[model samples]
Target: MNCEHAKGLLPALLDTALPADETREIETHVAACEHCTRELAALRKAAHLVKELPEIEPPPFFAKKIMAEVRAASVPKLSLLKRILFPLHIKLPLEALAAVLVAVIAIQIYRTVGPESLRPSDMDPPRAPEKAQSREVAAKKVEIEVGPYQSRTPVVSEAERPQARDEQMRAAVDKAGPRRAPVSKDSDKKGFAAPPPAKKAPPAPDELSKTSLVLEKKAKQSDVETPRASAGAGAAGFEGPRYKKPEEEKASKPRELHSDEIGFTESPPPAPARTVEAERPAPRKLEAAPAEPAPPPPAGLARETGADMALDRPWLDESKKAGAEEKAEAEERPRAKSAFSAPAASAPPQVVTVRVDERPRAGEKLLELLPSVGARLTRKQVRFDRDVYFVEIASKNLVALVGKLKELGTVGKASVDTAGDETVIELRVEILGRPQ
Candidate 1:
């Protein structure tokens, strides 16, 4: 064997894989050729060194890492189309689902806007000869009745005729229950016409006398039965018609006043005398105090005039008393204070503008320090620009409050412009931060 063939068989000879004849030929070549001998010797030394080395276990997942690297290197660069359609295991199932979705969509589309043949319209069958004959007979009857007018009027079906429409309206009204009475032409004219003059015959003299006697008797009974009340009440708690005695009736005379004397104060109709009181029982005394008595009339006026004054104007005394009381109240009411007078002390709120790196953190710190320094937070305002906290603290504790707040953030100088009587100070702590 040549040196080239011997070199090729050297590794197989080292592993004892070569046949005896080949091994003998390779060894014979190696012995003759210096180059093959050196190559064989070097290979033997490497094999011996490998066998003498300690057997060390490979790292965890060594085989998996190597196989992954081999696979990555073996894979060819994919075109954009191939890359998009990669991962056949998952993509194939997705493609199948897409196909099914498309089929379902196609079915939905077909159902919504399908061809006309899929759903044909129903056509009526031809009428029977007997029915056609009956229709012709009906048409002939219409023609006989409306022969002359039919040319001028539009053709109307039986259902659309005025008589038929009126019948239908009546039927619908009957079905729904009548809402109102149907008004006819005669009734409409009668509704607008003036009614016949009511002929009320004058009552007979006998009936007139009887009615007057009944009314007088009822008036007398009510007057006697009802108790006498305040002066505001008419006569004896009887405001109805008052029957006069025989003397009053004879005394009452109807005197006409001329137009020239219209303004002249005529003597008030003489009050009916208390003859009814003589017939009535004495009235019981009322529990309520009597209303203020009307002022006594002058000596020139008769006693009857005093009764007239009380009956005519009982409200005079009440109105006068109310006016007097109102006048006294007006005099006693305190006058409003002048503008110059120093009113109650109320100090304006002092704003303490505080600049801080973090507003929320500073606010938390301020909240924690408020109670320790004897200050109470009245209101907390969170706005877009800044956070404001209203604090009410005693004037004595203001210094301590400020000192404690300085630890949280930079505190601004606040002027203490409090009123002399103001003991509490309202401090507005405005915490500011850098703009976002």
Candidate 2:
């Protein structure tokens, strides 16, 4: 029944599309509202004008012509070359088919050949050319020296010279007797081999005078060899520029002597062999020989030794002084205490028995009063008729605590027993309820 609903229905009413009930609603709204009536009238006028308007007729076959034009516009024009080269319907399908055929053929080939056929083991190794093989063989056969000297000379350190001389002598003896069979390289190819010849004998002593004299002579020779070599190089007129600086020449020393250059490879003449006893019994005494007592150390040495012993532990002197001081202080301590301080004679423990009515109330009251007398409850016991409290307090506060107890309850049996050196007294308070 609002203006909006009426306006919507007004158009339907003009077209006779609305039902009677809806039409009645719009009619009633239009009659009640002037604005709705004006709107309904305008709608009716517009509908009537529309009904009177002449119909517009399009060109003959208009839909067919428009569709033809749209089709023509939508399709692109192809050049002769494009049309000839790119016949999509045939070429695209053929290309796709060709690609599919190629993939299928590749897959079939792979499946037929298998991955194992392409493995490295199945292929033959490439062979080197004849000239290269011959060159490699020649290289293996060629003897090339390694190290500072490009000769067969072996480098020997100063320490190894004596051992090498001894070894050469031993090798000479062995060669004179019987030569050992040469070990085959193939026998050691599997890693395990016979022990080396050098390990058979332990090394001989190196302190021989002859060996020392030989070593000294070789050292002098090595020292002289460097200056001689330099002189020779200069005398021969080396045209090459000087590569070594003066500092380097000064800093560098002569190279170590090689075993071959030092003549250690030559064996010395064999000495005459001495007679060897097969076995001699170890010399033993039938009886144990008495041991001789050692002579005492001299007086001066003993005194010096004693002084050193004393100096070694200066703490002994300090400790002795400290101990003497402690002893003196210990001796004077009693005298000082007797003179300046008095001994406190502790009184014996006293027991106080207190009687009261309403024992529980009286026990609680005693517990409250204990702190004032500097006392603590040592023990508490609850009996059927009475409650007992044992308290510990200082001897000086004994009299004060007894007086305070008299105020709490009756002091029935207050007694002090003789004791020795007890600073604190244990008090027994018995609170008894009155008989009903």
Name the candidate that leads on TM-score: 2
- Model 2 earns a TM-score of 0.22
> What lDDT is obtained when candidate 2 is compared to the true structure?
0.39
Residues 25-110, candidate 1: write the lDDT tens digits. 88888888999889988999999999999999999999999999987776654444576667875688888999999999988766
What is the C-alpha lDDT profile of model 2 across 1-436, one tens digit per residue?
A: 7888677677887867878887887888889999988888898899889899999999899999999998777665545456667778469888899999999998776544333213212231121122112222211111111222332211212212212212222334434112222212211231223211222211212223434434443443344345433422221111011111111221111122221222221221121111000000000000001111211111112212332223212322333455544433332222221211111112222457688877777777888889998877745655555666767676567777788888877887776542222234446667677533
RMSD of 2: 40.8
Q: Which stretches of candidate 1 lie over 4 Å from their true place?
A: 1-347, 418-422, 434-436
Task: Write down the TM-score of every candidate.
Answer: 0.21, 0.22
C-alpha positional error of residue 354 in candidate 2 after TM-score superposition, expressed in Å: 99
Per-residue lDDT, model 2, residue 358, is 72
